[model samples]
Target: MEIFKSDKIFDFMGKRLPFLALSALLFLGSLGIIFTKGLNFGIDFAGGTLVQVKYEQNAPIDDIRQILQAHPKFANASITEFGTPQEIVIRISGSSTELGNDIGDTVHTLLDPTGAFEVRRVDMVGPKVGDELREKGIMAMSLSLLVILAYVSFRFEWRFAVASILALIHDVTIAIGALALFQVDVNLDILAAILTIMGYSLNDTIIVFDRIREGINTSKESKLLLVINESVSRTLSRTTLTSLTTFFVVVTLFVFGGEIIHGFAFTMVVGIIVGTYSSIFVASSFLAQLKFSVNNYRAREAEKLKKQKEKEKMRAMYEKGTV
Candidate 1:
C-alpha cells in the first residue's frame, strides 16, 4: 500500500522537470480563468429570489421553469429538482426586473389549488446587499490566506510556509475554476463551503508539514529527503482513513442534504480530494527544493550557546567584584 518505499524516494527526481512544467501550466490556466471567465456569482452575490415549491405528485421540473419563464419578470428563471421529482426549486434574477411577491403569488395562483402544491420557502436578496456580500466574501478569503501564511510560517520553516500556502492557493484556484467552467452557484452557503474547503485543505497540508518537521528534527540517521519520504509513507494510513471518512460524510450530504445545501456539500467533496492531492504531490514535493542548510542550523545553535555562556561569565565576574 505504500507508494514511497526506501527505493522509491528518487523516483520523482527523474520526472521533476515534467512535474514542474505541468504545475506551471495549471497555475497559468487558473490565472487565465480568474481574469477572464471570472466567478459565476450566485444569488447571494448578484442578488436574486429563491423559491422552493413542493407538490404532492412527481412533476416535471422543466414544466415549472417554463411556467415561470413565460412571465417577462421571471424570464431568467432557472429551475432544478429539489428533493424529489415532486419538489422543484426556482431562481429568479434580483434586479429591476425582479418579480418579488408577484412571482410567488403567480405560482400560487397558476400552479396551486389545481394540484397539491405549496410554497415551502421564499428568499429575496437585494442588489445592495449582494454587493456588500461580494466585498465581504473577498475580504474573508484574503484574511484567511494571510492568517494561514503567518501561522504556518511561525509554526514551521519559511519553505514549509511557502509550500503550504501555495498548495492552498492552488486548491482554491482549481475549485473556483471548476465552479466557473461548470457554472456552479457561488452563494453564501457556497462561499462558506469554499472557506471551509480552504481550512480543510490547510489541515491536510499541515498534517504532512507536521510530519516533515518531526522527521527533520528527530532523524539524524536518515537523509532529509529519505526522512520526508518515510514520514509521508508512515502517515499514509491515517490520511487515507480520514479522507475516506470525510468522503462518505460529504457523499451522504450530497445525496440527502436536500438541494438547498447540495452545492455546499459538493464543494466540500471537491475540496477534500484536491486538498489530499496537493499535500502529497504539491506540498511534499516542494520540500525537496527547500533552502535548508544544516550548517546554518548548527551555527545558530552554537551562537545561542556562546551568548548564554558569555552572559553567565559576565554575571559571575560582577558577583565576585561585589563580594
Candidate 2:
C-alpha cells in the first residue's frame, strides 16, 4: 500500500530556490490579505451575543432578517442558518448584560411571534473578556513556537531547529491568512485548530529531520543537499499517505460537520496541506541553504577533541609537577 515505491528520486532540493521564492510570495500575499481584509472574527473573540434557535418548522431566513432589522436594537445583528433550515444562529455585538436579560426571549418573541421557535442556547462575552482572550491566544501561539524552537534545537541542531520553526510559522501564517482571505469566522475553535496544526507540522518536520540525520550518519553522500534530497525521497510515501488520510477526514468534517466546526475543519485542511509542503520544500530546503553538512559536525567534534586534549595535557603537567 505504498504510494511511492522503489525509492523514486524526485530531486526536491534541486528546485529549492524556486520553491522558496514561491513560498515567500505566498507568505507576503497572505500577510497583505490579513492586514487589509482582516478576519471575520466570531463572538468568541469579538465580544457579542450568540443565540442558537430551532423553529418548529422551516422558516424563511429573509423574513427573520427583515424582522430583526426592523428593531433598532437588532438592526446590525448577523443571522445565518446553523445546521438546517429550521435552525438558525444569531450574533449581535453586545454582551448578555448589555443586551439585557430578556435578550433570548425578545429574539424568540420577535422572530417566532406565535411561540413556535425555541432558543436552544445563548452565550455572551464582554468586550474586555474578548480582548483578554485575544491576547492570550496570541501569547499561546508565541510560547508554543518558542518552546518548539528550544526543543528542536536541543534535539537536533540550532540550524535545523530554526528552519523547522520558520516552516511552522509559514504554515500557521498561511492558515490564518486563508481565514482572512476567505472571510471564515475566526473563533476559539479555529485557534485550537491552528495550535493542533503546529504540533502536526512539527511532527512531520521531525520525521524528515530524523531521516536526514540518519542519512548523514550512515550514507556516503558528501553533499548535504544530496543527502536531504535522498532522505525526502525515501520518506515520500509515508508523508504523502499520512497527509492524504488526514486531508480526507478534514474534508469530510468541512463538508458535514455543520457551522460550529466548519472553521476548525477548514483550518485543519489548510494546515495539513501547508505543513506537508513546508516540511519538504521550506524546512528541508532551508536546512540545505544553511549549509548543514558533515563538515559542520566534524568541525564541532574536532573542537571538542582539541579541548579534551588540552585538558589532558594540563592534567599530565600538573601530575608531573610541571608548570
Candidate 3:
C-alpha cells in the first residue's frame, strides 16, 4: 500500500528542530511522570494474592473497600473493576496459598453472605519470587538495550548506533510512562510487550539507516543531509504501511481481547505510535546531530585501511624475526 507518493521528495529535515523539541518534551515528561507516579506492579512483580469475584448485580465498590479494610487480612487490598460493574478483582500483598484461600472465603462471606457472588479466579505469587522476577525483568530490559547497542554498532557506524539507541530509549521510556500515568498493572505480559516494542522500534530505525547507507554507497552524495532526506522519504511508504497495519490489529485487540490481555494490547498500541515517531523524528534528527557525512565515512574507512596495512607490515616483520 503506497500511503505516500513514491516520487515526491519530503523535506523531513526542514522541520527537524520542531519535531526534536516535541520529542524532548515527551521524553522528559515521561521520565518525570514515571519517577513520580511509579508503576502499579502486578502480582508477577509484586508478590500478592488475587481473588476475582463476580456478583449477581452491580458490585458495591465502596462497600467492598470498607469491608476489606475492616478485616485485618483483607486490609490494604487493591480493588478494581475487572470487566464490568458486576465483576470485581481484589489483590492483597502476600503469597501464602492456604492463607490466600482462607482470605478468599472471608471475602466471599463478607462481600456476598448470600453466596450469590462467585469466585471466578484466584492467583498467588511469593514475595521472594516476585522480587526475583522484578530484578530479572529489569536485567532483561537492560541486557536487551546493551545488545542492541552492540548489534547496531556492528551493523552500522557508531553514530548510527548511538542515534538508534537514543530513539529506542525515547520510545520505551514514553511507553512505560504511559503505563505509569494510567496506573496499568505491570506483569509478565506487559514485559513481553515492551521487548516486542524494542524490536519494532529498532526495525524501523534500522530501515532508515539502511536506506541512508545504500544511498551514500551508490551516489556521490556530498551532503549527508540530502541523502538522509531522500532515504527517509523513500522508506516512508513501508514504515507507514507497517505501522498502520499493526495499529489496526492492536486496536482490535484492545477492544475485544478482554481484561486479561487489555494491558498488553494497550502497551502495543502506545508503543507503535511512539516507535513510529521516534524512528522518523528522534532517530533521524539525532543522527544528523552527530554531523556525520560521506566525508566522515570515507575518512573512517581510510583510517581502517591504514591500520590494516600497518598490522600486516608488523606481522611480516614478526614472521621474519625483525622485532
Candidate 4:
C-alpha cells in the first residue's frame, strides 16, 4: 500500500562542502563544551537525597527552595515542580553523617509543620551507586553503537555502517552538550532518551541506505551522484512525513507531559530532526564516495583464486603422470 509520495523540492544534493563544515563545527563545539564543563549529573548520577513531598494544596516551588536553603545542610539543593502544583521534587546534595538527619528534619518542619504535607518518599543513594550507574550508562551506549555498526556492515557495507554510526554520535553529542550548557540533570531518564534517539536515528539511516541500495541495483546507467540524489529525493517524502508525525506527538508530550518527561520529550524531538538531516546529507553522501561493490569484488577475487588453484593442480597431475 502506498503510504506517501515524494514532492520534488529544490534538490538538496548540492553545497555538500558547507554542510560538512557546519556539522564539523557543531561536533567540535560539543566536544569542547564536554571537556571544559562536564555533564551536570543529577541525583541519579551523583547519588544524593531524593525527597518528594505532596501538599494538600499547590506548594510554591520557590518557597520550598527557600525553605531548603534556610538550612545550611540543604544549601544549593535542586527543586522541581512535579505533577500537580501540590507536589515538589527536592534533590539535596550528598550530606555528611552529621547533617543528614538534620536536613530531613528541617524539610519536614517546613512542609509538614502540622502534618500538612506528607513525605511521599525519601531515598538516599550512595556515591558508589552513582558511579556504577555512570559506568553502566556508558557501557550501554558503547555496546549499542557497536551492535549497530556490526549489523549495518554485515547487511550493507562498511561505508554505510560508518556514516550511520557517525550520525548517531552526532545526535547524542549535541544532546549531551545542550544538557551541559543548560545544566540539565543527567539522570536515568536522560540516558533513556539517548538510547531512544539512537534507535530512531539508526532507523532513519537504515531507510536511506535501503533506498541507496535499491537505486544501485535497479539503475544500470545512472551516475553515482544522480543515483544518490534520486535515492534521497524518492525517500524524502516518506522520511519527512514519518519524522513530522513523530515530531508532533513528541511536541504534544513536551507541552503536556509535565516536568517528569519534559527533558525526555525534548531530546526525542531534537533527535528526530537531526536524524532526518543526517540520513540524507550525511549517510547517502558518504555512500557515493565509497563506490565500493562488495558482491562484485568478492566474486572476482574468488574466481581468480579458483582459476590459479585449478591450473596448479593440473600441472601437478601432468608431472606425476609423466614420472
lDDT of each: 0.76, 0.89, 0.89, 0.77
Q: Which candidate, 3 or 4, has the higher lDDT?
A: 3
**131: Cα error in model 3, Å:** 1.1
Q: How close is candidate 2 to the true structure, as a TM-score?
A: 0.90
lDDT of 1: 0.76
Give the residue spans of candidate 4 off by over 4 A.
1-10, 56-67, 70-72, 80-86, 95-106, 113-115, 289-323
Candidate 3 residue-wise lDDT at 256: 91
Can you tell me which runs of candidate 1 are displaced by over 4 Å?
A: 1-38, 60-66, 96-103, 221-223, 301-323
Q: Model 4: per-residue lDDT, tens digit, 240-313?
A: 88888999999999899987788888778877877778777876666655675635645555697899999999
lDDT of 1 by residue, 1-323 (tens): 54334333333334445665666677778678767887778778998887888888886666666666776777877888876888877777767334646667777876653467888888788888999999999999999999998999888777788888888888888777777766778888988989998988899889987876666656573355566666676666667778888999999999988777878898888888877777766777676677565445545656978999999999998999953
Pairwise TM-score winner, candidates 1 and 2: 2
Instruction: For residues 88-186, write the lDDT of model 2, one tens digit per residue.
Output: 888898564668877888987787663388899998888888888899999999999999999999989999999999999899999999999999988
Q: Which segments of candidate 2 are over 4 A away from where they belong?
A: 299-323
TM-score, each model? 0.82, 0.90, 0.89, 0.80
Q: Looking at candidate 4, what is the lDDT of residue 228?
A: 70
The candidate that wins on TM-score is: 2
Clashes of each: 0, 0, 0, 0
Q: Candidate 3: where is the Cα deviation over 4 Å?
A: 94-103, 298-323
State in Å the error of residue 8, model 2.
Answer: 2.7
Better of 2 and 3 by lDDT: 3
Name the better of 2 and 4 by TM-score. 2
User: Which structure among the candidates has the greatest lDDT?
Assistant: 3
